[model samples]
Target: MSKIAVIAGSLYLWLSPGLTMGQRTSGLIGVPDTSFTVHSAYSKAKKTHPDIRIAAPALPPTVQANLNVVYCNQNGRDLHIDAFYPVNQSTNRNQLPAVLLIHGGGWRSGDRSQQIPMAQQLATNGYVAVTAEYRLSTEALYPAAVHDLKAAIRWLRTNAREYNIDPDRIAILGCSAGGQLAALLGTTGNRKELEGTSCHTEQSSAVQAIVDVDGVLAFIHPESGEGDDSRSTSAATYWFGASKTEKPKLWHEASALTYVDKSTPPILFLNSSVDRMHAGRDDMIGKLNALGIYSEVHTFADAPHPFWLFHPWFEPTVSYTVNFLNKVFSKK
Candidate 1:
């Protein structure tokens, strides 16, 4: 057998001892590739709000976009980031605050393009906004995606002058899985262990604020319903390369709640009616409150998990995000 096939076979055996070699191989290899895209999300959203439309990806007259700019190069894979900034920002005497937008696809799917419209809107609102591409579970794994995002943050700071960005005033915003990552990044900033040895090591990956849209804050909390494998290996399973029971420490380590401290930056939770999606949010907020840190929560009534992808919700999502960033970053 080829080396890859042999390895895959070993993985099957390791992942599921109960299954026969053939059954395990089929289960492992038959996993379908995720098809999480703007169109797909729109279709899902339209089922409930038929009149809702996908937000326009066009840049506003006052906004300028630099698409597909490579920000990190890892082992020949050039991760790209799309940057949107206000027109004439180059001439501005003051450095503009920036936000990096991360998309959600259960940490396995979705691309930077998913947040293009949000980036454009943020740019129009006078902030330098960037949507980053990170390695997904299919490409790498858990900490790999985290490392890629941190690299993107460092890259932004490294090029802050060129982008007219205030390195210290940056925020990170994400939806769903991306929101979980944004929250984790906010809490784990400057932690040497979580900081991957990727590009821009000299630059810090710390964010001044965080906006998490319907993302869970803990993978192993009592309020969390993650790691349900009754149907099949869950998204978290694929990302962690093991089940919660198999790698409890990994699950706890990835949870943002594990690293919450006084040094953690302000956070905003924009959630939908789906309670499980925002699991552990309240607990984390309570911790922040005890630490005297700033935090806000805005829940959309009866909204879909991917509400940010569609019309009515999209506009409000943008509004809330901008307002929260303004409130948090406006502070010293």
Candidate 2:
């Protein structure tokens, strides 16, 4: 058997002894048991995919980075973005594709800096990449973070020429809470209500693709509550300003799954096998497939919720993300 197949088989046996290979194809099986051990499965997968390494590859000499460029001034705060792009223009005069990275902290903490490494890496690989700041739950409520993200999209479009970016070829990538926002940004593109009266209102906030890294899809669905605890539920309550039961409509409205349709952008979901951070992800992928929209899901065996932030898994995460983005952008 191939090395990858052997590693996968070992992972399946170690992680989900109950499920067959066919059953694990969707990448949503094997919710981590509380007593689940870690490191071994990921270590095996790493050994198998040896090409995936932690060190960021050297960039071309022409790559440039600009930090703390203000994208918006909202609620007495100046939202900033760190942009990384290549100085060398494309041969055909066509603008380069852009990517916006959103950081995650359950919509409460975390900052744009969390995604700086990825943004820089993307820029080095011939893309204009940006890491943007948005209002957290501590500063605002539910829709506020969403609005900030949409506004950031608008900001990119409005300043596309300045950054040598193709406005229509923009994609969004987010992890954890940011993943939820990125998913919502992709699904609710045409929804006028979610597009708040923030900066750059004239430009469309729609994205061409979405890369959601372990984000919740449905806030109130039964699957959403499957692996959640009181602390996670409390984070939702804090963000929405009410319990799910107290404001059912708000919770539903905030859910990305509620807005899935034919118009939703193609999505790539990267998740850890044992972590339930992205509850209802498989169902969301199923809905996207039903609508004929493109979707891909890859699960790293025995990985943690924040796998992308560390070594071994981080390399695979970036590889999959760059490949997916390249595929989606090339067709546009």
Candidate 3:
């Protein structure tokens, strides 16, 4: 384990030594309702870049889509996935690789439809692409969303034949809060504790590649601006059910940086110019290098934090993801 991992695992242990096992902490603050939709992001971006516009939600003619398919039923709560694939599927062709897209809304406000445009583009590019819905902080707490996403991955693999997808060639991508979850899913692929009870126990939740778009890798790092509740409750605080000061353990445990090891798959970080958005990223890449794992980073300088939601940046985001997925999945 690295220094960051050590800190991540033990940050609050010494501070709360007398706390009992599985003791539920309470009185944690919550944030006001905030919309994290693509429209909201585009509206915010348009303020700075007037010419930038939102990406169209239409799928290309070459793509076939199956929307609102139930991928998991968690205690009767059904989670859905929207799958997109090539329209002209030939029986003789090889099984297509797949990419599962996760939406970012600070783990509170985003929806699966936010990833629809990107999924469409990926499907048009000869891959089985999907957008998944998970239990957000508003609906549940930390590990619930994690388990939900892992279930989505397993669902993709379990139904691989039906979707013409290669069970082993799946990638996960997320923006902002979704990016954090994507990275966590990638790094903790083998950790049984993080795999919450969902459907498809026989299938694996591991992803072959990860694309983290403008998401923080660590919540407790010096570079991280998370948990700052001076003006309002930060999104990280909202998702974790407590402020970083009050529940450092949850903060550490949720960080993707805490779990990165040699077993971690290749990662591609698509970031904005905002340094805080990519907190703990440099250290993460450093660790990946030492572990002999492949990782890539591309910063869109001066771009809005929600660049993936808008026009000019959206195209390159998809392009980088497609290229990276091809390179990493090709090794299999």
Per-residue lDDT tens digits for candidate 3, residues 1-332, read: 89997984463342222333243323122332357777777778888899988887687998988999999886556889998899866462699998889998888787888899999999888899999998766555677788889989989889988888898898999999899899999999858988876689788999889999998899999999988999986777766767787778988998999988888999999999899988999999999999999999999999999898887888999899889988998899
For model 1, residues 197-315, the per-residue Cα lDDT tens digits are: 87999999999999999989999988888889889888887777778887788889889998999889999999999999999999998999999999999999988889898878889
RMSD of each: 4.6, 14.8, 8.4
> How does each model score on lDDT?
0.85, 0.76, 0.84
List the candidates ranked by lDDT, beginning with the highest: 1, 3, 2
- For model 2, residues 93-205, the per-residue Cα lDDT tens digits are 87999999998777766777668778877887778999998866555566777888899999999998888889889999998888888898988985798888869999999
Error of 2 at 58 (Å): 8.3
Off by over 4 Å in 3: 1-34, 90-92
RMSD value for candidate 3: 8.4
Ranking by TM-score: 1, 3, 2
User: How much is the lDDT of residue 164 in candidate 3?
Assistant: 84
TM-score of each: 0.91, 0.80, 0.89
The count of residue-pair clashes in candidate 3 stands at: 0
